[model samples]
Target: MRITTKKLVLCALMTAIVFLITFTPFLQIPSPMTQGYYNIGDAAIMIAAILLGRKVGFIAGGIGSLLADVVTGYYIYAPATLIVKGIEGYIIGAIANKKNGVPSRLRQAVAVTAGGLEMVLGYFIYQATVIRMINPTLGMASIIADIPGNLIQGAISAVLALVFLTVLYRTNTVKNLLR
Candidate 1:
């Protein structure tokens, strides 16, 4: 695919935004369930998906989240973060842009909900199986305990994303530039 200067620039900006948002110290709730902590980086991921299309969202979300994981010294999670965030971004963008125009409120809600669930499920699956394999002592019970934290993280991110998106939608400036 030929890259347009516009797309290149937007992708770069969005990627930077995602990285900054993910890297910055956000409200983190410590989970007793596992080594993982819940963060609101998903809010930024949702915003990127809403502003950009699927391809750009996937690239920005994946690389940005992967970099965040590396920078945060969570290197073990970088690979999973890449795939999970990429899929999350793609799902949001695909649902939001379903009509090839302005996304409806319902679509936006669906996108956020699905994307949030994707993140929660993706990490859950990774931690439950893959991490369990790395450490045979890890039990399914311990992994299952993380569900509540993940659910809380997902819910908060969705609310944050919805609020941000709503404000952006109201201001035609950003919306116009996105188009």
Candidate 2:
């Protein structure tokens, strides 16, 4: 596909936005036991995935999430962020591309599922590889403890994405840009 300046700018803008949102409370937080950390950045990634297709979505999500990690000094999570966010975007975009139903609902569901997977997988990778080496068997508890948080994040992101998309769909700016 021929890349347009508009698409490139759109991708970069959303990536930076996601990175900033990752620092905000509306985004995921770092803690072993905190359940229900809502990540608004995931919604941004999901929106990009739904609108821009898988390749673009994955690039945006991966880069944005990595930048967030760097800016936040969460280097331990950077590798996982890159891989997991890319997967999340690809998963959501793939499902949306195949959808033949209530596209909005399908997009929400797909995005949430993708976000959940990203959190869970990322936590597992980061803990097992980095955290657990320092404290053995701790990774297991870390994974288990994150289940609720991942679920909560997923649910919140889904709702937020749905609402945001609904509003954006109504606007001529998003309609022209996203479509």
Candidate 1 residue lDDT tens string, 1-179? 89889889989888888887788766556566667667877888888888777887798889998888788777877899999999999999888884466678888899999988998899889998788888788788988888878888778988998888888878896657866
The pairs that clash in candidate 1 are none
TM-score of each: 0.92, 0.82
Kindly report which residue stretches of model 2 are placed more than 4 angstroms away from their true locations once superposed. Answer: 25-28, 33-38, 98-104, 137-139
Candidate 1, position 82, lDDT: 95
- lDDT per residue for candidate 2 within 76-168, as digits (tens), equals 667877888888877777777734423667556766676657766776666667666755656476567777776776667767877887787
Best by lDDT: 1
lDDT for every model? 0.83, 0.71
